[model samples]
Target: MKIMFVGDVVGHNGRKAFQKYTPKLRAERGIDVVVVNGENSAAGKGFTRKSLDELYQGGADIVTSGNHVWDKKDVLEFIDQEPFLIRPANYPGEAPGKGWCVYPFKAKNIGVMNLSGRAFMPPLDDPFQKVEELLREMEKECDLIFLDFHAETTSEKIAMGWQLDGRITGMVGTHTHVQTADACILPQGTAYITDLGMTGPWKSVLGVQTDKILYRMQTCRPVRFETAEGPSVYSAVIMTIDDATNRATDIERIYLREEEDGIGL
Candidate 1:
């Protein structure tokens, strides 16, 4: 099965780029499933129900999120009703939504888990232990598994990838909007990458306007960050897994350059 994972979708521009490029990519890569991180989908903060619906209609099969998942209060109620949307599993139990879900893929059961890292991030439950427990339950019924490790530190992401190497089919990092150079399969066959990168203007400061970020840093004053609106780029990864062995056999990074035609989506 071929699957595609998109990094953090910034805002209007990001959504447009994703919608414009995803269909072509699906055809070009023969992607069987598409997963996207929608934490910053709504005005570069958190996703709203309407935004999530738009992303789903745009070709994402599953929408994942990170620290900003709860920025929108409406999601507290909407996530439970939507089976394809997931938040970090390491979050407090009282948090809204679930950390993982299982869906039927062809004749096999596929599971997706969302996890958060504590390093340079909000304190959360132990991701390593939580993942082990969840995998044990999923292994009983599912053969294919995908992990979205929403984290900041590269060390944490790499450690988690190695920890679940042989147990899961694929593991990819998110949250940090810059793409990393490490995109390779582990010795145990799991496909991994430090980050999938941002889906908005790469010329800006991680999808935010550079001036705004600079001003805040210089003045040490409160400032609201907005998504950069300009020529952008979209980054993602496509993975092919062998169902028989539940391992990723092939992986490729996809970079889409967006034109300045007022955003495609």
Candidate 2:
């Protein structure tokens, strides 16, 4: 089975890049499932209903999110209704959306789990413990398991990878918006990457307008940030998993850029 995991989509440019590249990439690579991080899909902050619908129309089978999931107040209204959209499972039980889900793919159930890290991030429940709990519950119901570990520090992400190395199908890190050079199969057979990178304007700072970020950094004062415009880049990773063993056998990083003409350059 081939699964493609897209990095965080920042705003308009991110969404456009995703819409432009996803379908073609899927066809070219024979991707069976597509998971995207959409926490910043709504104007670089939170997700909106329209943005979620756009993502679904753009061919995302499941959308995962991180700390920015709640940036939009209306997310509380529809998060529970959207089974394809999931937030960090480490959030409190009363949180609006679920943290993981099992979707049927090719006559087998595939479990996708989302977890948030505490280091340099908002205080949330212990991701390690939450992941263990979910694993125990999902192991029996799914043929393969994949995790989106939204985290800040590389240490935290790497620790999570090692913690569940042999047990899960794959573990990909998000939230940093910068793709790491490491993309390899673990000793235990799981595919891993420190980050998938941001799928937005490549010239900006993490998808934000460069000037705004630079001004803030230079002045040490608050400055509004807006999503960058112009040419965009799509960042993702494709994983090939063995159906019989439910282990990832290969992983490859994909980075495609769009020219000003809206064509992949």
Candidate 3:
């Protein structure tokens, strides 16, 4: 099975790029499923029902989120209704929506899990301990498992990868908005990457307008930032898994900018 994990989608531009490139990518890579991080899909910081629906329409089979998942109050009302949309599992039990789901693929059950890192991030339940419990339950009924760890520190991401090296089908990190160069399979066959990168503006600061960030940096005063408009950059990774072994065999990284890919789309 081939699954494509897209980076965090920012705003209008990011959504446009994703909608434009995903179909072609599926055709080119023969991707069986597409998972996208939609935490920043709503105006670059949060998920609204409309934004989540847009992702579903753009070919996302599952949508994962990180710290910004709850930025929009609307999410609290509709998150529970979306089965394929998930927030970090380590959130308090009262938090709405789940952190993982079992998607039926062909004849196998594909378990998709989302977790957040506590280091340099919001204080949530312990991911290291929480994942083990969730894995035990997911393993019983799923043929393969994929985890999207939305985190800040590379050390924490790498450590989690090592901890679950041979246990899961694939593991990929998100939230940094910067794509890492390391994309390789672990010793135990799990595909891994530090980050999938940002699927939004290419020349801006992490999807925000360059000037807004510059103003804030230069003055040391608060400045409202907005998602940069115009052409976009698409970032993602594809993991190829062996059906028989239920393990990843190869992982491919794809980073494309509209400016170069197709003349600013």
**Residue lDDT tens for model 2, 102-133:** 98987889899999999999999999999999
Please give, for residues 61-137, the per-residue lDDT of candidate 1 as tens digits: 99999999989887877888889899999887687788888878789888899999999999999999999888888
The runs of at least 3 residues in candidate 1 whose Cα sits more than 4 Å from the true structure, single-residue gaps closed, are 259-265
What TM-score do all the candidates reach, one by one? 0.95, 0.98, 0.97
Give the clash count for each candidate.
Answer: 0, 0, 0
Report the Cα lDDT for candidate 3: 0.92
Sort by TM-score, top down from the best:
2, 3, 1
Candidate 2's C-alpha runs over 4 A off are none
Clashing pairs in 3: none
Q: What TM-score number comes out for model 3?
A: 0.97
Residue-level error in angstroms, candidate 3, position 188: 1.1
Best by TM-score: 2
Poorest 10 consecutive residues by lDDT, candidate 1: 256-265
Work out how many backbone clashes candidate 3 has: 0
Q: Better model by TM-score, 1 or 2?
A: 2
| Model 3 lDDT per residue over 1-265, tens place | 8999999999988888888888889998899999999999999999888888888889999999999998999999998998899999999778899999989889999999999999999999999999999999999989999999999999999999999999999999999999999999999888999999999988799999999999999999998889988778899999998888888999999998777445643
